[model samples]
Target: MEAFWAAAVGIVWGLPLVILLAGAGVWFMLLSRAAPLRHAGHALAILSGRYERRDAPGEISHFRALSAALSGTIGMGNIAGVAIAIAMGGSGAVFWMWVAGALGMATKFFTCTLSCLYRKPDSQGVMQGGPMYYIEVGLGPRFRPLAMLFAACAMVGCLGVFQSNQLAGLMQAQWSVPAPLTGLLAMTAVGYVVLGGSVRVGRFAGLVVPLMCLLYLGGGLLVIADHAERVPAVLRAIVLGAFDVDAGIGGAAGLTVKEILVTGVRRAVFSNEAGLGTEALAHGAAQTDEPVREGLVAMLGPFIDTHLVCTMTALVILTSGVSPQAAGVVTTAQAFEASLPGLGAGLVSAIFAAFALTTMITYAYYSVKCAKYLFGERRGGAFVWIYLVLIPIAALWTPTTTVNIIDTAYALMVIPNMTATLLLAPRVLVAMRDYFARQEG
Candidate 1:
């Protein structure tokens, strides 16, 4: 199983997929005229209720949709995923991660706008939208096979296994709790929210995401402040390592510049989910008539997840003198412990608990949406039970196996999603021009 998973990840995440994802992001960035960066403040304004519409044709508010999406993206990836990138690819990997995050903003803007623009009503008449809906509606029924392909891959990709696996590992390491018990507790917590549907998920996300982010960011800031003198040196190492061909240390001697780029881009996509199309399921539910506004709001996700949160984790790991051989959540815990003494591991455990739990809940929503799309809304509840059961099973898997499974599934999802997004790019550009013109007028 391990060998199979390793081979699957290697093939799916190879150079061709990497180039497709990155090249699409660059194309979107250039086509949009860098609107994600240029109008970031405006995005925040939309998030803050500036253009809110109570009578809009959707289920949840913009803030709640963004929160639900962030809940999925901001969890273990920010904590353990960054550590994995640095562990496997060296500190220079963080530089490429930053590059991915920057271009990802544009990807989010275009994909999310299309999600909102082409929403369709499900069997029960709930407004449904995502990459699948947009592909069928915007690109025509001839492309529905591609849409089904995305939904099929998403059912497996957004399973929350990595989050559950890492959270279970943290519990055993920090408190010696058994993995089964942690998995059961996690499954129960996530099932409670996801069963209540998107409204419950949105409200829970809006309330929890800000608090968890503040707590984690506050802890990360303290660590950085305590080691203020080492910041410059760490930053230099990251930038230089990004381009260094023979800069590997110890067992990392095989880490070429290509490996660094692949690892960084791969981790960044996993962290922020820019091209994965999962977040569109959440953002597609936003209660607004303006698709462009939702796109602008959605673009902030990569900035927050990868640029701000992941960078903090990288700094903590790099400056703590931990060996690059240390991987995943354990390395992050060591960094926190070194910087904060007795409080580090415990605080991180708490933050990880919050992060992982929220992620599971949101991911369940994504899976249910995929199931509903494929099997109809009546069968959606069945998928929820299936998703809940998988959490415990996932907890039993090793971290390496869990990561490989998710990376392979996510890479498969990106293929159809990026292809559809590229084909429909002109529609998004037209919407952007009209939306901005109306705002100015």
Candidate 2:
């Protein structure tokens, strides 16, 4: 199963798919004139609870929605994923990560705008929205297959096994906590929140996201400051590495520039999920009818997660005096251990637990919604119990295997998602223009 999944990742995530994903981002950024970037301040205001409507049609506040989305994107990917990128593609991979983050903002803007533009109520009469609703409703019922495909892919893609595997790996390595024990705890915690659905997940994320991000950032800054002098050289490696044709490191030597680009973009996509359409699922539940508003808000996910959190993790790993090894979460824990000595492992473990738990629950929200789309709320309800069972099972898998499954599932989702977004780009353009005009007026 692991080898099959790995093979599937290579075949599906080839150069053409990388170009399609990154190129779509570039195209959306250019087409929108970087509108999301320019309106970021406004987006911040909206996120700050300034634009909320109590009687709005959606289920959660903008803050909770964004938090929920951020939790999923900002988890294991920001740490383990970034470390993996550096270990494989060299420090230069961080450069492509920035490119991916920038382009992702535009992708988030367009896809999420369509999310709100065509949202409809589910059987529960909740105003649910996502790639599925927008793809079918906005593109017409004839595109139902594409919508179905997105939902079906989402069920597997959002399982978040990588998060479990990496976090469980760190715990097992550092504290000798058994993976099964860690998985049981995770299943209980996640199931408690997830059983309550998106509202509960959103609330959990809203609280945990801010605190965990701060904790992780605070710890990261201390390590970076301790090795402050090495910062310049590490940054240099990241920049120059971005353009080198043979930029790989360790066992990944002889890699081409294309390989580096693919690695960076792929990791960044996994980290912040710019064009993966999962961003839309969270934002679609925000308590507002304005499509452009949510798009603008969703644009912040890549920026905060990829640019800020992932960059911090990258710098920490590079500057911590730890060897640039490919041990995923264990390597990260070592980096923290290098600086803080007696306190490193414990601190990093806490941070990872916070990050990974929030992500697992948020992803539960995404998967459950997709299940509802594919199987309806009744039978879909069964997916939660099934999802809970998978947490412990996933914790037993190797990180490579878990990552491969996620990559393949996400690859499947991107096709239907990007196709729908690209086909409906003109409508989003119109909405963007109108929304801005009203704001200025």
Candidate 3:
């Protein structure tokens, strides 16, 4: 089974997909003329409710939309995923991750802008938006095949199995909580929020995502501060390692430069999910007429997830002098336990659980969108139960199996999304330019 998954992941995440993912981001950057990156300050303003219009045509506030998006992106990927990257690809993987995050910001701006521009109202009168919508509505029904492809893959891709599997494993290892018990608790918490619908998902994410981030980043920063002198060396190693084929704790495992680069990019993409269209599903629900406004707001996700949060995790692992070769959660825990002794690991465990729980809630909303897109509203809404059922099953799966399933699904989903986003980017670019021009006028 492990060998099969290894082969599947290798094929799906091979050079072609890497090029597609990174190439799409570069293409977006050049096409937008870095407009979105330049206007990140403007994005922050929209996120801060500076230009909120509650009466606008959408289901959630910009802040809530962003929080919901972040809730999905900023979880175990930042925790265990980064650990995996360092273990496999070395400190240099961190460098490639930064690269992916920077390009991801631009890619997200394009995708989210299109989401709002091409949004459609559902039978219930709530507006619907996402890659599938833009692929069908913006590009005409000729592109409906791509839209369906994305929806199908997204239903699989957005399951949060990685989050559930990692969190459950950590709980069982650290606290000896049974995996079934952990899954039950997570499913109950997630179901409580998600069963209430998108409004509840948004409200819960808006409240918890920020607190979770603060808790994790705060603890990580403390460890870095304690080893202030080693920070420079760690940063230097990251840069130097990027080109070192013999980098990382697993170097003796015979990884090459290409493998190192790909590892970093894959892990970073897993964390931020910039081109996978999940961010679009969330931002597509923002209350705004100006799609560019939401586009800019959506741009912050990769920065926050991969750049800030993942970087914090990497630095803590490096500075604490922990071996990156250790098991993902164990390495992170050891790093923390080294710095603050008894308190640090416990805090990370609690925070990981919160991260996992919130991630499950947000992805539940994404899964619903995918299901609805495929099965029609009446049948699709009932699919939430299916998502709830997967939580505990995922908790029991080995991490290797869980990650491979998600990664393969993510790869499949990214193909249609990046394809559609590239084709419709001109429309988003036009909308973005006009919105900015109106602001200037």
lDDT of each: 0.84, 0.84, 0.84
The TM-score of candidate 2 is 0.89
Worst 10 residues of 1 by lDDT: 245-254
Where does candidate 2 clash, by residue pair? none
What lDDT does model 1 reach?
0.84
In model 3, the runs with Cα more than 4 Å from the true position are 1-7, 87-90, 160-162, 240-263, 322-330, 393-407
- The sequence of per-residue lDDT tens digits that candidate 1 reaches over residues 31-140 is 98897679999999999998998889888888899889988888665776787677788888898999999888999999899999999998777788899999899999
Task: Give per-candidate clash totals.
Answer: 0, 0, 1
Tens-digit lDDT track for model 2 on 1-441?
Answer: 878998999988776776787899999988999988999999999999898888888888888988888887776546778877877787788899999998988999998888889999998799998999999999999999989999998998888687788779878887899999999999999999988877888898899898888888888898889889988887877887788644423223677777787888988866776777888999899889788999998888889998889899888877765344544333666777877898977887787778888888888888999999999989997999988888898899646776788778877888999999999998999999999999999
Give per-model TM-scores. Answer: 0.89, 0.89, 0.89
TM-score, candidate 1, is 0.89
Residue pairs clashing, model 1:
none
lDDT of 3 at 106: 96
- Weakest ten-residue segment in model 2 by summed lDDT: 321-330
